[model samples]
Target chain A: MVELLAQTGLNAVYAASYISLVAVGLVLIFGVMGVVNFAHGELFMAGAYAVVALYADMHVPFFVAVAIGMAFVGLLGLLMEWALFRPLKDNPLGGLVASIGFLMILQSLAVMGFGVRMEHIPPVTQEVVRFTDKVGLPVARLYVIVAAVVFLSALWYFLKRTRFGWALRASAQDPEAAALQGISITQTARIAMFIGAALAGVAGALTAPLVSVNPHMGHSVIVTAFIVIIVGGVGSLEGAILASIAYAFVHTFVTTFWDGVLADIVGLSLMLIVLIVKPTGLFGSADRA
Target chain B: MRNFLILLVGLAALIALPHGLSFSQQEILVFLVINVLLVTSYRLLTLTGEWSLGHVVIMGVGAYSSALYTKELGVYVPVSMLLGAVTAALLAVLLSFPLFRMKGFYFLIGSFAAGEIIRLIWKRFREPFGGVRGISGIDPMPDFSVGFYQFDFFEPVSYYYFAGAIVIACLWILWRIEKSPVGLTFHAVHWQDKLAQASGVNLRAYRTLAFAIASGFAGLAGALQGHYVGTVNPNSFDIEVMVFVLTWAIVGGTATFYGPILGCIVLTVLNEIVLREMGLEQARPLIYGAIMILSILFLPNGLESLVQKATRRKTTAKPEEKAAT
Candidate 1:
């Protein structure tokens, strides 16, 4: 039983890593643009597809394919800024509606290109690290965990230490004030979108081999990301990461003990309880809430 | 007298509409009528200036409730349908407790979380909800005869007439609510709740009232769908359906009562008849996505703006002529 619990804990850590990637991106976009990018999940799926095309089908190295996935999806983010977000800057609701439109387009394109069936990518490595006689961790999952840690640390450093980071944070806090300060709102928006989209894409690319990759995969991904971000607080990056970890542990344990649907119910209920008890979230800023 | 004549003519035309269409078109017409009710009720909720992401789930509540009532208790199908709407409304009132505490985007996400919980509940329990597969072989509306027309539940035309009557009546009540002083208070809340409160308005109660009424009518739409289709499932009330409803409300523009209805009717015809006939079944989502984007980009005010513009020009031109005289 101890072994089972430890194994589940390790599994949850891995789950939290990817979830944080997606949730953080969502939070960043919401903070900077004030629009919920419903297509954010599709951006993740786009990353996974990048892996399927380059690594699985074309024989590129896994890391290279993942890099391309992030960059490619980052570019898609720029396209969104240029086409949708920038135009609908004044109307957050309109931007949200446009994102929904983008989501459908991406999903349909995936269906047209890859067909509706799930894609199975070959494992990058067969090795598993065993902590005990019963407990094991796949090397691929470790890669995801490691990537999440490195990228998140890098993001933290950027947000804290860099001039652009200050500008980004300033803009997120108050766009009009940031504009008054001569920090280009347009430039900050572009940077936020690119970085946010890249995180989701990288997460998706890394996990593509480990999970069932399909056109409709983004639906559950977006739902989980929404849960994480909401529980973490809407616009707080640190809160998103923390909430992701907490949610991952509870959800993983629940799924292990009971069933998937029940786990989902529990996760949603936890969010509701948090909303009722503290509408701003556990670590959220009240001003933003 | 002229307005009453127009109403009579409109009702007659609507009643005769299915007769002109083919059998399959008749089926589409029934679904369209139900969608009209669905979108209009959604507009009712939005009148409080709250755009809920869970309206479709609330509608599903009605569907499941009505289905269970008729299936498990052997209640009269129509009466069960009414109970289903009540269940949805009561659920909305209850949900408003936690949901109304948050405003704007927080409210949107809160409502979404609340909805997912409800949907997950329906998925988890198989006894009543039938688990993931959902309840099938639900009781159909009993066949009957009106004095002038035979009402066979199996026929799409019959259900169209039945649902159309219900929908029209619901739409009338919705219209009345929108025109009433209570609706002005709702608009007040939407525009500026603080001011509305200063004027002695119970903001929370009014918001809940709007939500409950909207959910009730949405539930009625759901019950109509349930009896017509003879099945109910979690998949039927998924987020994708919610997206469609959202698109309809936006594309039609929610500024006017008839806006969403216009959007629903046009989109349904385009999606069901045109796209299906053109052998672009697989491309429906693609086309829908394109339309949504294009509409938001080019026609941000929605298709209703065009109608509003035309009417405004006529009224403006008439006033100028009268002023010259």
Candidate 2:
């Protein structure tokens, strides 16, 4: 029982890693750009497809493929900002609607580019690290977990230790005030959009081999990301991380013990309960609610 | 008198509209009519200054419940649909307890979570809810003979007319509600909740009222679709459908009652007739997406704004003559 529990715990940790990566990116975009990019999940999908194209189909090195994927998705994010969000900046709802439009376009393009069938990328590695006779962690999953930690730490350091980070934070907190201080809102928005989208891309690229990559695969993970961000607070990065971990544990345990659908219900119900009990999320201060 | 004449002509045109279409087009017409009701109900909810992502799921509540009433208990189809709508309204009231606690973006996310939970429940349960496959072989509306026309359940044109009549009646009721003092209160709550509260308006109650009423109508729409399609599935009421509703409302401009209806019709005509005629079914979503983005970017006020503008010009130009007439 203990071994089984440990295995589940490890699995939950892995889930937490990717979930936090996605949620943090969502939070950052919402915070900095003041728009919910509904196309975000599509950016992640685009990243995964990038890997499928470059590594699986074209024989590129795995890490090189992931890097290109991340860059490509970040570029997509930049395109969205320039084409949609920037023009609709004054109207947040308009921005959201436009992002939804972008999402459909991306999905349709995916369907056109690579048919609707799920693509199973060949496994990157075949090794698993065994902690015990009954517990092991696959190397692919470990790559995701390690990459999440490294990227998140780097992001944390950037936000705290860099001038661009300070400018981004200032703009997120008070765009007008930041503007008064000569911090260009457009520059910060571009930076935030790029980084936010790249994080989702990397997460998707890293997990491409682990999950079935499909045009509609974004739907489920986007729901999971929404749950995490809402539970963590809309604009709080640390809150997003914590909420992702908590949600991952709960969802993993529920799925392990019961079923995936039930796990989804439980996760969503938990989010609803949090919204009812604390409308600003567990750690959110309602800065931009 | 002029307004009445216009309305009569519009009604006549709608009645004549489906006859010129092919069989598949007539089928699209039925779903289009049903969607008109759905989008309009969604507009009613937005009037109270709250936009719910759960509106479609609530519609599903009506569909599932109505289907169950007919399938499991053998209730009359028409009566079961009403009961299904009532059930949805009651469910909205219950959900409002937790949902209305948040406002704006929080409310949006909360509604989405609440909706996902409902859909997941339907997917998880197999006994009554029919699990992932959903309830199939639903009871269709019974055939009947009117004085002038024989109604059959099998023909898309028949179903279109049937659904069209119900939708028109629902739209009329919705219009009446929107024009009433309660509707004024709803607008008041949306535009200035603090002021409305100071003016002795119960904000929560009004929000809940709009939500319940809108959800009830949405349920009716769902029930109408279920009977026509002869099936009810969880996937049918998913977020993708919700996005379509949002797109219609947003692209139509929600300031006027006719706006979303106009948007829904125009977009449906474009998507169904033009896209299909061109043999670009695969590129349909792509073009639709491009249109959505273009409209938001360039025509942020929506297609209705153009109509409003044209009317404003006509009214301004012919004020004296119009008044004299």
Candidate 3:
């Protein structure tokens, strides 16, 4: 029983890592651009497809594929900002609708490119690090966990120690005030979109081999990300991370104990309860709420 | 008199519309008529300044319940459909407790989560919802002759007319509601809720009322669809369907009652006729997505704005003639 609990804990940690990566990016884009970016999960799927095209199809190095995938999805994010979100800046609902359109396009493109069938990608490594005879963690999952921690730490550093970070944070707080301070709203928006999209991309690329990669995979992913972000607080980065961890633990435990469908129900119920109790979210800003 | 004449001509055209179509095209028309109701009902909710992602699920609730009512309780088909709408409305009122707490973006996500839970529940319970497979082989509306016309349930043309009548009736009610004082309060709640509240409007009650009414109509549409298709499944009312409703409303411009209906008809025609004829049916979603993006960018106010623009020009021209006369 102790071993089962420990194994579940480790699994939850892995789930939390990827979830936070996606949720953080969503929060950053929402915070900076003030758009929901509903195509976010598709951006994550785009990254996994990037890996499928590179590492799986072209035999590129795994790390090289991941890096390229991240950069590629970041550029897609930039395109979204320029083509969709930027024009719809004043209309948040329009931005969301446009993102949904983009999402459909991405899914259709994937279907056209890869067919509807799941692509089987060769594993990065087969070695498992055994904590005990009964408990084991795959090296591939460890790669995802490590990359999440490193990228998140690097993102934290960028958002805190740098001048660009200050500008990003400033604009997120108040775009007009930041604009008065000579911070380019457009520039900050582009930076935030790229970073936000790239995080989701990298997470998808990292977990591409661990999970089945398919055209419709983003649906569940986006739902989970939405639940996490809502629970964490819509626009709070720290809250997103904390909520992701909390949600991941609960979801993973429920899945382990009962079933996937029940876990989903529980997670959604939790989000609804949170919404009723605190519309601002656990760590959300009062002013924004 | 001119407006009444136009409406008569429009009704005549709608009645005559399906006769010119091929069998498959006629089938598409039936779905199109049903979708018209679905999108219009969605517009009703948007009037109160709230957009729900769960509208499709509420529609599904109607479909599932109506199907169950007929299958299990052995209720009459028409009565079962009404009960289904009532069920959906009641569900919306219940959901409002948790959902109404959030506004704007939060409401959007909250509604989505609530919808997903309902869908998941349908997926989880095999006894009632048939698990993931959903309740299939739903009871169809019984055939009956109406003196001048024999109302057959199997023919798409007959179904189209029957569904069209219900939809038209629903639209009439919806239009009346929109034009009434209650609707004005809804718009007031949307544009300036704080002021609406200051004016002694019970904002919560109004929002809930709009939501329930919208959901009731959506449920009716769903029940109509289930009876036509003879199946009710979880996937049938998923987010993708909701997205289609959203796009229709957005592309149609929800400012006018006719906007969303126009958007639905135009897009459905574009999708079914144009894409199907070109044998690019597989690329339909891609083209639809492109259209959605392009419309949002260029035609932000929707196809209705174009209609309004042309009408404005004619109406503006008419004033000069009136002065000359």
Using all chains and alpha carbons, the TM-scores for the candidates as numbered come to 0.97, 0.98, 0.98
Docking class of 2: high
Clashing pairs in 3: none
Predictions ranked by DockQ, top down? Answer: 2, 3, 1
Whole-structure CA lDDT of model 2: 0.92
- Which 10 residues in a row give candidate 1 chain A its minimum summed lDDT? A280-289
lDDT of 2 by residue, A1-289 (tens): 9998999999999999999999999999999999987888888899999999999999899999999999999999899889988888898688888988999999999999999999979999999999999999999999999999999999999999999999999999999999999999999999999999999999999999999999998898889999998889889999999999999999999999999999999999999988888767899995685
DockQ score of the complex predicted as candidate 1: 0.75
Q: In terms of DockQ, which candidate is strongest?
A: 2
Q: Could you report the DockQ of all the candidates, in the order they appear?
A: 0.75, 0.84, 0.77
Docking class for model 3 is medium
Interface RMSD of 2: 0.9
Better DockQ candidate (1, 2):
2
Provide the lowest-lDDT 10-residue window in model 3 chain A. A280-289
lDDT by candidate, in order shown: 0.92, 0.92, 0.94
Q: What is the TM-score of chain A in candidate 1?
A: 0.98
Candidate 3 Cα outliers beyond 4 Å, as residue runs: A286-289, B318-325
lDDT of 1 by residue, B98-152 (tens): 9998888878888989988888888889998998889999999999998888999
- Tens digits of per-residue lDDT for model 2 on B100-190? 9988888898899999999999999998899999999999999998989999989998898898999999999999999999999999999
